[model samples]
Target: MATETFLASFGLVGLRLIERHGIDPAHFARELGIPSTALPDARTRLPSALLDSAFEKAARCIPDPAFALGAAECWHPSHLGTLGYAWLSSGSLRTALKRMARYTKTLGQRMSSRCVETPEGLQFIYDHGRGDTLTGWVMADFGLSLIVSLCRTNDGTDLAPALVTLRRPTPATIRPYEDFFGGPVRFGETHDGLLLSWQVADRPLPTSNRELATTCDAILASELATLQNDDLESRCRAHLLHELTSGEPSDTRLAESLGLSTRTLQRKLAALGLSYRGLLEKTRYELALRYLDDPKKSVTEITFLLGFSEQSAFTRAFKRWNGKAPSDYRQSPGS
Candidate 1:
């Protein structure tokens, strides 16, 4: 499937949110030739064009001008699949955001985003890849609001940004945007994203779980690697290099991302003379040793980078691999 488009369930969930406002979502879906999925599974992807139509209809149906902001308020992680879990388990807002930019295909596939570190703060550049600004504000608003929500959830604060920008035309007054975002918002701007402070992005999350995050990253990476029919091991390893920080992914999740069932993935791995767990361990070890070689990064940091739950856990595993702690190995000039 093409990258950046949302899953079927995301479309379905948007309908439900519309319905909550007493708008018949099915009518709009049917009117636009957007098929409504009976199931809530986030597997099928519809083009961004269809979603843009949905947003337009949703705006028409709702009398409220801030419907997009409200739609994002209704969003839950389930609407995003493993991307939600990965965001939830991120070590910090900055790390989570980098992961989001890296795996945008699995989440908001049509929304282009980047986190740029500036002297003042982090400026997140975001834009709807295929929609005109006239009706694109809904998608843009929903995306920006969701990013704000994710940041708040990670740092557990009011988490206001330094500045916010939108691609939509200027409203009658800026009060609604400011009131909603808790910051000054610029309409008719060049971009559609937030400018946040370094203090907010650098703050660590209480729910940080390196191992679990690595698993999520594995799914995230595989979702973006759908162009070729390369060897499963090579493809898997290549994806692993990008995703291992999210944590070890489940067999079913990884299999689905690879466009196969668990049995099929296992069979292919077996054909290649490999098992999923074995490959995962080997990848982790390789990453661990590589990270350990750099004395500047503490083992605590390396532990999270390798997706270990904690430093002590990484230490125990490193000892098993090299018969010495990571600190000892880092100190040793060589035997």
Candidate 2:
């Protein structure tokens, strides 16, 4: 089985910040086991360990232990591609967050986000199992800062979290976090997340473009369907695993990857009582449980990895397949 990977984009943002401070990104990447050439593509799927390694190396070179906070200061919706557009046009911060939690896989495949409502307000959680290394600390900061920054943008005003929580211990001085988030910071929590007042989520986005959001949704939906409509079962599985790991899942791409005519491919699968759709369903079910077993991937991430259009789609399918939701299966004393 392949070791799980993460979107290198999050770290790439930090690398640029390091270089902006006068250090060469290539040299930094080399110190972290990534070729400088390999560092440019934000969408590249790298061993999650490489990001952790790079973050640690970056800490030794940069003066600030909390450089991740600074890097997030440069974040913009455009950095996220379609996911960003979907957010920009969302009807409200709450709706935008729903979109973010749903499609975060497009930004970081192994990263999972959850948004829940509480009496206190809205809580957004960013969870990645990067351990206690400097990379882990930076990633936690980066994730927290990114979302809070987003919340600020969504409201078109300066804002802060009601409470910021980190799984790691408090840094030597909690001032950086408190200063950056403009709120109280709490460490040694079981998870990494930040909270916002309920009002922040309920307000409408001035830039909300429902038509564009719908268009992006359609495009994403088409991509998901394409993954399930492709060539021979054996070749389809090979192509799905290889390209879908980092690229969009498309039937034309799969056929090209297998060097088969689309018609010819259809005939081949039919030879074995297989349909592309059937193969996709079986393959997704097979891979879903496997990916979920890893603490590194949240249920949301596994849904996208398995080519389901949405997390709910994966859950419904899982229920049909095993008579229980994925969470129920995984959380059981024995999966």
lDDT of 1 at 222: 62
Q: Candidate 1, which segments miss by more than 4 Å at Cα?
A: 1-5, 34-39, 227-335
User: How well does each candidate superpose onto the true structure, as a TM-score?
Assistant: 0.67, 0.62
RMSD (CA, Å), each prediction: 10.7, 12.3
Candidate 2: global Cα-lDDT? 0.69
* Model 2 stretches astray by more than 4 angstroms: 33-44, 219-335
Reference-based lDDT, each prediction: 0.73, 0.69
- Across 136-214, the per-residue lDDT of candidate 1 in tens digits comes to 7777877788788888887788888899988788877667678778988888787788887877776767877766776
lDDT per residue as tens, model 2, 27-67: 87777777653334534567766766767777777787777
